[model samples]
Target: MKSQRHRITDLRTRRRELQRRAATYRASKGTPYPVEVHLLLGQTYLDPASWDALLHSRGPAVALRRARFAPRYDQLLRRLEEAITRYERP
Candidate 1:
């Protein structure tokens, strides 16, 4: 039997693979991943551009990852948004 962490990690791994495949498909065929998977891996690293791309892809899997990882990514986005909002406030 797999440990819970292992199971979660496996799930996240699958999600990542799907995300990668989806990105490739979107680039080559202009489409998103066929299957939408949830459960984000805690250690995955994505740059802002990739994050934005994923968000804009509008795939359910992306949505799931967004929801799961929002707590982490959202903090950074929120801070950036706040800084922009403050800086623009002449």
Candidate 2:
């Protein structure tokens, strides 16, 4: 069996890879999957400053912009699929 420290290290590596992937995707596409965007937006809302930024940026006026995220949704689905595959690869 792996040591607990090793498992924790592996998890951190995986998280770093995921964030790297997200950054690469964002750099190339200027946006990410809708699910990713949703997650980010949720996280943002949980912060006072980010929530204030969103509230003052466009709010309901730009909500329709979110509907145009089919490509990003596809990207997120691919990431989710990969995560599932990895988890099941015992």
Candidate 3:
């Protein structure tokens, strides 16, 4: 009845608040790295062998080039994963 309606209204408000927080986070902390490269690095994190092979086929120097940014990508992934966990919490 009235209690149920109030519960629903409260949930909707919470949802809107979470959405706003996510939008603000994205605006302020968006990654400067290329999306394609980020996705590829994600896959690399998951499957090192496949990434190694792909990079190997591309060129020997390619891995060296990416090595410079490996730490940065790792940091970015960790931050993104933590953000996702926070967003998923009730």
Task: Single out the weakest 10-residue window by summed lDDT for candidate 3.
Answer: 3-12
Candidate 3: which stretches are off by over 4 Å? 32-90
- For 1-90, candidate 1 gives per-residue lDDT tens digits of 763334434444544654464355457755432222112222344655765554465667766765566455545444433433333343
Q: List the RMSD of every prediction in angstroms.
A: 16.3, 14.7, 18.3
Candidate lDDT values, in order: 0.46, 0.44, 0.46
Per-residue accuracy of model 3 over 20-80 as CA lDDT, tens digit each: 5555655677734335433533442424464444344445465454454445544655555
lDDT of 3: 0.46
Pairs in clash, predicted candidate 2? 33-72, 34-72
Worst lDDT run of 10 residues, candidate 2, spans 41-50
Give the runs in model 1 whose Cα sits over 4 Å from its true position: 31-90
Off by over 4 Å in 2: 36-90
TM-score-wise, the better of 1 and 2 is 2
How many backbone overlaps does candidate 2 show? 2
